[model samples]
Target: MRVLYCGDVVGRSGREVVIEKVPELRKSLKLDFVVVNGENAASGFGITEKITNSFYESGVDCIVLGNHSFDQKEIMNIMSSDKKLIRPVNYPEGTPGRGAAVFKTARGKSILIIQAMGRVFMDPLDDPFAAVDRLLNGNRLGSQHDFILVDLHAEATSEKMAMGHFCDGRASAVVGSHQHVPTADAMIFPGGTAYQTDAGMCGDYHSVIGMQKDEPLRRFTRKIPGGRFTPALGAATLCGILIETNDETGLATSIEPIRIGGHLKPTL
Candidate 1:
């Protein structure tokens, strides 16, 4: 199975790149499944219903959310309607949307996607470790599910790495998000699971984590909010990780980093 995991989609540039490239990538990369982090898809804040559907039409298999999951007030309704849209598993119980889901490919192969947010320097949520363990407990990866993708939407590198090691051999891939900056560590673990500290953002890199540089620079240098942060309209660099996994073993055989379009050197 070949899966492509895209990091946070920040805004217009991010959405546009994904919409334009995914279909082409699906064919060129021979991708069987695609997951995108869309927390910041709507103007660098949260995702909207129309934006979500646009992504689906453009070839996204599933969409994941982070701390900014509910920024768009209407997403709550879409979550109840769309099972392919996932929230963080560690969110408090009774949260409207599901945190994980089992989706299938065109060939009927099962792929389980579970998202968990870390507590370090983040919102107070349930134990991410326990949430991940609960999902992987008896759901044997190779036997029960053809592939398993664990998305650690975290801020700290240690937390993301810990999750990868914790789910080693249990999941097909463990990737990080939220920082919107791709890391150099893209490798398959000894247990065969693919890992990357961050897949980066599909937005203009000339800005601060996808937002326009002005406000961020002002806040950083002046220590005061002068204006709202907006998405950078410049050309974007789509960033993500692609993994090739063994079908029978349901473990990653290879891992590759992807960065293309604007700013960052192309890694397609």
Candidate 2:
């Protein structure tokens, strides 16, 4: 199984790049599945049904959410209905959407996608490790599912790497998001699981982490909020990781970083 996990999509530029590239990538790479983090898709706050549909139409198979999962109120209306959409698993019990789902590819192979949020310097959610363990316990890789991918939406690199190691040999890949900056470290773990500290944001890198520089700079240097942070409207760099998993073992055989357009140096 080959899967492409895109980083957080921020606002219009991010969405545009993803929409423009997913189809071409799916064909050129022979991708079986495409998952995108849409937490910041709605003007860098949250995702909406319309935007999610656009992504689906453009060849995205599933979409994941992070800390800002519910910034857009309308998400709740379609959360349960949209099986392709998932939120952080560690969220409270009553959260509308699910944290994990098993989706099949055109070849009828199962792929389990699980998402969890870390607590360190982040929302005081339930234990992410325990939350993910419960899901992995029942769905064994190479048995119940052909592949398993865990998206640890976290703030701390340590937390992300810990999750990767914790799920080693169990999941096909463990990738991080939310930092908005791509890390250089992309490698397969000793246990055969692919790992990356972060896949980076799919938005203009010229701004401060995909936001217009003025407000972030104001809050940083002046220590005051002049205005709300806005998404940078410049050309975006689509960032993500591509992983190919062994069919019989359900472990990653290769992992590669992907960066296209915008300011970051291109890689594939």
Clashes of 1: 0
Best by lDDT: 2
lDDT by residue for model 2 over 1-268, one digit each (tens)?
9999999999999999999999999999999999999999999999999999999999999999999999999998999989999999999999899999999899999999999999999999999999999998989999899999999999999999999999999999999999999999999999999999999999999999999999999999989899899999999999999999999999999999999999999998
Output the lDDT of residue 262, model 1.
90
Query: After aligning candidate 1 to the native by TM-score, how far in Å is the CA of 11 from where it should be?
Result: 0.6
lDDT of 1 by residue, 1-268 (tens): 9999998999999999999999999999989999999999999998999999999999999999999999999988888789889999999989989989999899799999999999999999999999999999967898999999999999999999999999999999999999999999999999989999899999999999999999999999999999899999999998999998998989999999998799999987
TM-score versus the correct structure, for each prediction: 0.99, 0.99
Q: Estimate every model's Cα lDDT from 0 to 1.
A: 0.94, 0.96
Q: Model 2, stretches more than 4 Å misplaced?
A: none
Model 2 pairs whose backbones collide = none
